[model samples]
Target: MSTTTHETRIDVDPDVPLVRITREFDAPPAKVFRAHTDPELVARWLGPRGLEMSIDHYDCRTGGSYRYVHRRGDEEYGFHGSFHEVRPDELIVQTFTFEGEPDGVALEKLVLEDLGDGRTRLTSTSLVDSFAARDAFVASGMEVGVREGYERLDEVLAQG
Candidate 1:
């Protein structure tokens, strides 16, 4: 058995209104892609651990749309997005919007790279409309969610 640990790296562009995230997974690209496209698998590992996620609708194909809600105690947060392009186990392009800040829509692209040995690297970039918007996103404690979510995903992938 191989014992390897992966960490998530988030980079905020100082000049451009973009944020880039990179993480490695022990599973292959296809498996990692499935975890992202499948709503059930996504809900299992998509956010911070304490929140309960409920998907209103999750259509991951090209031109498909999705809406999901995360609830923590008495607070509920909603997010919706439209998939612009989807390529199985390779790429995904989408628009993301948080209900709280409807004006701050972001265009995101995710790419999965095969690292051989049953491992994969996932890189995602989110481009917001303005630097303020990007800064706000980074300040929102998204790193916690990203790190914890990937950790959960590692467990999910290991179960197979």
Candidate 2:
């Protein structure tokens, strides 16, 4: 269960307001899905490694909403999202918003593909309002958070 063995791919569409991220996990879809849907599991591995995450509320179901904060020393970043659709071990569609940028709401879809042999491929696509918004997101050092977060997730999955 080495983090360096897995690769996380991030693609930013030049002509569209979309970002696609794909990653493979050694665990099954059910395990990865639970890590996403379960609030406690999510809190364990959802951001940069050194940030402490706290969930104000997390309801990962259809029509539910969630709010969480990531804190690093004196700084805190808040994020909230609404779950539009949630299908067990298959898909999740949600709206994501960073509290700091209220105007940049993005619709996100997460799909889990079972790759057999207890492996799963997780693909997430985020559609924002405009290309500018997407560009800003890509320029915001998001890759660090995403890569480190998935590495942490790998550790969590290995523990199970």
Please name the candidate that would achieve the greatest lDDT relative to the true structure.
Answer: 2
Error of 2 at 70 (Å): 0.3
Once fitted onto the true fold, the runs of candidate 1 whose alpha carbons sit more than 4 angstroms away are 1-4
Task: Give the TM-scores of the predictions, in the order they appear.
Answer: 0.96, 0.97
Model 1: lDDT of residue 80: 100
The lDDT of each candidate is 0.94, 0.95
Backbone atom clashes (below 3 Å) for every candidate: 0, 0
lDDT tens per residue, model 1, 1-160: 3335597999998889999999999999999999999999999999999999999999999999999999999999999999999999999999999999988899999999999999999999999999988999999999999899998899889876
| Per-residue error (Å), model 2, residue 137 | 0.2
The pairs that clash in candidate 2 are: none
After the best TM-score superposition of candidate 1, give how far the Cα of residue 92 lies from its true spot, in angstroms.
0.7
The CA-based lDDT of model 1 is what? 0.94
RMSD of each: 1.5, 1.1
